[model samples]
Target: MNYMISIIIPVFNRKEYTRECLLSLGKQTDQRFKVVIVDDGSTDGTEDMLRQEFPEVEVLKGSGSLFWTAGVNMGIRHALKQGAQLIMTMNNDVVTDEHLIEKMYYWHEQKPEALLGALELDANTQQPIFGGERLNWLLNTIEEVLPTLPKDEQKGLHAVTHLPGRGLLIPRVVIEKIGLFDQDRFPHYIADYDYTHTARRAGFELYVNYDARLLTYPEESGERQIRSDKNFKNYYKHLFDLKGGGNLRDFTRFTLKNCPAPYIPFHLANGYTRRLFGYFLK
Candidate 1:
């Protein structure tokens, strides 16, 4: 049976980025999909812009509390209600090839029960930034594995442990089985890992389609440190900040949720403590 496709984007205030993302979607080789924007209290008149610019796209307003996870959940809920059999979640700061959806659909049709991801390349250098990832809890390291995969897999879809929410495709059955992202524990950060890991445990395969390519502004990602002075105060400040990459609270929660019971503490200490050392000692 043919499935209705929906691409869901969550935007806070980056209106220009959202505009560019929408434009790329419009130029897709396959226009057999709809767009949904979950605007979580964008003070930059994003709502007005969408109304004036792309009125055909649906906009859902939130009370500013919903961050990435909740916003995506909101979009998925709406999409499901609108008869969306397949849902794609993405970040706004991205542009795509004209055949991105077509390529993703082509790979997804081969194994419909799996979670599919689009290859994310850096917008400037055209180097792949994110394609697929393997989380090594023993070493507490996450490696970008798509480029190093077997050639056959490179030409096709590469199986993975988890896929980021950026340009991730979700079949309706996965949601029906595993439910939505755990927004309460992972509102803004680490939510994608949690969702995909959960889906993997629930018997869903994760694959990244290298042929489905999109350009993302890697420099515009979450902040890493407050300063280079190695000030202890700055380290502590950014460690728990929701928008920073060193979100210790969220990372700890993610480890506990995704890792095996015996490995949770080791993963946190071995991975984060070492990384924190770099932010301070280095």
Candidate 2:
């Protein structure tokens, strides 16, 4: 079968953001790509804009409350059915380089067995964002506490652990072999982590292509801290339970041996003790 690239953007009441994302796609140097826009029950003007302005874009309407995972799944299925060789699930609030699609597709063709292809995501300042790291719980916690360093310090060429879905490209074979994102464990946060780890277990590589770049709103400001809400915490708890490899016993064993204590208190002291315990124990 001939190959086509599919770019899927999940929209949730972000009409302007969706428009910008689509515009970026339309501006791609590679025009042989199909766009699948999954409107996850957006009441905003997203639907109308797609119908009127973007007739070439495929629009998938949600039944009702479709979160990130479900929305991405919807698009993935559609893209696969449309004979997509490469699938990219990105956020609505992102702008891609004109050459982004072609670069990503080249890497996918080169590394046909890769689990995921990641681009170096930049903030408005065009700084490189870290895609993935083999982080223990303690290191991850410390990373959260440290102030944002210069982008150059964070830049490197390496095989990363997780590929952020914000601008990820997945080979069709990986999707067929390993399957889609785990919506049950992750409706939103950390779905990419679960997907990448699953692929790693299956012996597929995870990579970052610095040449393929895009600008994303990386939750840099106060928005970095999601609002304090029980629903959000519930989402995270579900994420851990669904994503964790083992129980508290396993987590303790994994952490004490691999994780450092200094970073734990440094980054996550403000987190609730119960949350910390659950994360550490689980």
Candidate 3:
């Protein structure tokens, strides 16, 4: 049978998380999708384990330099070559709901032109983590959509300007239009944000489907902190760290690509100010 959807995942050394994620996919009610797991230089025997346990999955090899954007791009290229009608991009750390694909398909059927972003919940708290978001360029901030509302009340489709890359479903047509991610500018973080904004600019609508959800672990605490032991070194390292937005350089690139002319300076200043204050307080 021809696969209707191709699920693309970019993974590193997290074998346990990848295993659980694949297990969840195995339980998905809709079996019409194919999975493409891009192993980006995993030293933890991820490839061996996948071959033994999940032989049916197509495993694409990647050098560590590919990061998130390039790794997913490789998988997307393969999926497109295979003639996939739809593509789903996701992280290896998420355990998806069994009906996620089914619901996403239903939503896509309703609005075939829109990019569908799944609602993500915290694995420990089961509370909404990220669903839909709006970018406040003036304030240089991103606001969560209906964050305070109860989960049940957050049901239905919401049009959003910003969507997380954690779980995004895109039609093949949209990919053909927007093209692949910019790995040089955004190696890891914010690449998803950039892509969504590009799609919106290209006249593709973005939607968040509350019914399609996944459970993801919270980001590591203290990952963004500047250590006091080696103050200068740590501060410098933090400035270029991928998790905390990768310093002023990455922010500058993001602003130039996404922000309006008048707002670029404000965005850059706001980002630098936040990082400076955050480092001092740490």
Candidate 4:
């Protein structure tokens, strides 16, 4: 049977997280989807585990250099070759709702040209983490918008300017027009934002399907009360690490490529100043 949806996931050494993510996908209410997992040179026995346990999943191999963007691109190409009607990119760290695929398919049926994003919720607390985001072009910053609708609010699609790739669904037609993620400029981070921006520029609408939700764990740092580390050098090194998507160089590249010409310098200056301070300021 032809697959209606192809779920593409890029993973590294997170064996446990990958297992849980695959388990969640296996439990999805709609089983009309095929899973394409790209293991980016994971030496942690991730490949062996998937082969033994999730044998039906198509595992794509990647060199250590692919990172996130290239890994996802590999999976996308495989999915396209398999004749997937819709391609969904998801992080291996997330546990999706059982109805997530069903809801995504339903929403796509309603708006075929729209890119669908899932409502991400905190896995531990089960609270809504983020719905969608709006870009502040003036400050060259993206702000997360948490929908404050009532508990009984009707479940429907909401328009969004920026959608994270954590659980993004795109119809095959959108990819044909907007193309895949920019692996060169944004090999790790900012590729999601760039792709969504490109989709919007191509006249494709973006929407968050409230009914399709996924659970994600919060990042160790950022707003979650950072721990004081005496080793400032190591701290700074990790903070500016290109793999984690916090480096000033990558940020400057992303800003200059996507942001307005006049605001590029300000965006770079502001980001650099923030990195210099080493502490997030309110």
Q: Which portions of model 1 show Cα errors greater than 4 Å?
A: 147-153, 224-234
lDDT of 4 at 19: 96
Best by TM-score: 1
Comparing 1 and 3 on lDDT, the stronger one: 1
Q: In what order do the candidates fall by TM-score, top score first?
A: 1, 3, 4, 2
Model 2 over residues 112-215: C-alpha lDDT tens digits? 77754444456567765654555445435323211243445442224765667877878888888889987765666557767886787677888776557787
Q: What's the lDDT for residue 201 in model 1?
A: 92
- All candidates: CA RMSD (Å): 2.2, 7.0, 2.5, 2.7
lDDT, model 1, position 113: 84
Q: Which ten-residue region of model 4 has the weakest summed lDDT?
A: 221-230
Give lDDT tens digits, candidate 3, residues 146-217.
Answer: 675575778768888967787899888888887988888998888888889999999999989998999988
Q: Local distance difference test, per candidate? A: 0.85, 0.67, 0.84, 0.82
> Could you tell me the C-alpha RMSD of candidate 2 in Å?
7.0
- Candidate 1 C-alpha error for residue 241, in Å: 0.6
Per-candidate TM-score against the hidden true structure: 0.92, 0.73, 0.91, 0.90
Stretches of candidate 2 off by over 4 Å are 121-123, 136-157, 220-282
User: Model 3 compared with the native: what TM-score?
Assistant: 0.91
Clashing pairs in 3: none
Q: Tell me the tens digit of each residue's lDDT in model 4 across 1-282.
A: 245788899988989999999999989888888889999899999989999999999999998889889999999999888778889999998999999988988888889879999988899999887888788778666665565566666267878886888889988899999789999988887789889988987899998888999999877333232323325554455456655335666777777777777887787788777765644332
lDDT of 1 at 238: 59
Instruction: Please list the residue runs of candidate 4 whose C-alpha ends up more than 4 Å from where it truly belongs after superposition.
Output: 1-3, 139-143, 220-231, 278-282
